[model samples]
Target: MKLFFILFFLLVLSVVPAYSYLDPGAGSMLAQLIMGGVAGLVVLFKLYWGKFKSLFVKTDSTTPEKDNSSQTE
Candidate 1:
């Protein structure tokens, strides 16, 4: 295992040669996609905020003793 790891490390370190080019249009498209995803998440949360809040909240009916005091006996 040590020999294999050493060889792999050497192999990874020995190679380096390549210039990459990115067009301006591609960068703008990537930015738009990121912004759109964030906007969609915001809209989704707004639509489901009530349901999300309910997950962490305890309703009075779940524990009947609290409401029992309010009723006439």
Candidate 2:
């Protein structure tokens, strides 16, 4: 992780400028990529975090829920 940060920082600090022209579509794509990755990680964290917490904490949700189980018209 430390090495990855160092490499990223070096790349960000490079004196050479990029000569390539990035169109708006490419910029939007990059934005979506970053946002999608972050969203995916958040979802994964929520899923695993729930399981992790369940290891030590007990919830009543494990029992059969009856909110919509009975319908009498």
Candidate 3:
């Protein structure tokens, strides 16, 4: 594993940098993709917010009530 990582590191370091131009349309598309992801996450959370809250809240009535009368006695 160490040898593999060393080889991989050397391989990555040997790569030449590429000079590329990013057009305005590419930037706009990237921004739209990020915003779309954020919007989708917000909508998803809104839809599941109630279910998420229910995970921590105990609403079931099946459990028996604790005996509090003995405490008073």
Candidate 4:
């Protein structure tokens, strides 16, 4: 766990200069915008993935639940 944390921190730190020399021209700005949009989509998906998945899940409602199978003494 400690090693994982250290590696994660190092990976995060290593991305600091990824765009340090990128020019702020139109092309670069557009590229950054697209990257940011993709990142935003990824984060949004992570945030709502559970709800999204539940939307597609098939609930087994056809079979009535057995209420007296276990509760009866």
Candidate 5:
């Protein structure tokens, strides 16, 4: 499974062209890097989102009862 994934990734990367003439200015490079980083982060978060949400989710059966008692006697 791991080998297959690596091979698939390498195949995809091979198809992508290296930095071309269009990315000439610093601004363009920065923009591309930012967009790429954001896209990668989204993919990463999506992959782990289920586990991340489950981290905060309650799974226990017992629910704490609400306290309605007033401080004033």
Candidate 6:
């Protein structure tokens, strides 16, 4: 672990910046990718909203209660 950290520090300290140009098209593509991923997640959440909501919600009994008030003596 120590040797790994030493090597990582040396690499980071010796790293040189590459003169790169980020074109507008590449930036727009990256933005679209981020937005699409977010929109996809939103749609998935909307589709399974009921199931996701049920995870934290409590349910009452499914059986109906008997009404004794209508019983004859």
TM-score of each: 0.23, 0.35, 0.23, 0.21, 0.22, 0.23
On residues 1-73, what C-alpha lDDT tens digit does candidate 3 reach at each position?
A: 6545634664575464543233336546644543567564455445357556867998763343335433433
> lDDT score, residue 16, model 2?
49
Error of 5 at 60 (Å): 18
Worst 10 residues of 4 by lDDT: 15-24
Q: Worst 10-residue stretch by lDDT in candidate 6?
A: 64-73
Give candidate 6 misplaced runs (Cα > 4 Å): 1-20, 38-73
Candidate 1 segments whose C-alpha is farther than 4 A from its true place: 1-20, 38-73
For model 6, state the Cα shift of residue 68 in Å: 86
Top lDDT model:
2
Measure candidate 3: CA RMSD: 24.2
* TM-score result, candidate 4: 0.21
TM-score of 2: 0.35
lDDT of 2 at 52: 76
Candidate achieving higher lDDT, 5 or 6: 6
Off by over 4 Å in 2: 1-35, 62-73
**Candidate 1's C-alpha lDDT?**
0.50
Compared with the true structure, all predictions reach lDDT values of: 0.50, 0.52, 0.50, 0.48, 0.47, 0.48
List runs of model 5 lying over 4 Å from the truth.
1-36, 54-73
Best by TM-score: 2
User: Backbone clashes per model, in order?
Assistant: 0, 0, 0, 0, 0, 0
For model 2, give the RMSD to the true fold. 17.8
Tell me the lDDT of candidate 2.
Answer: 0.52
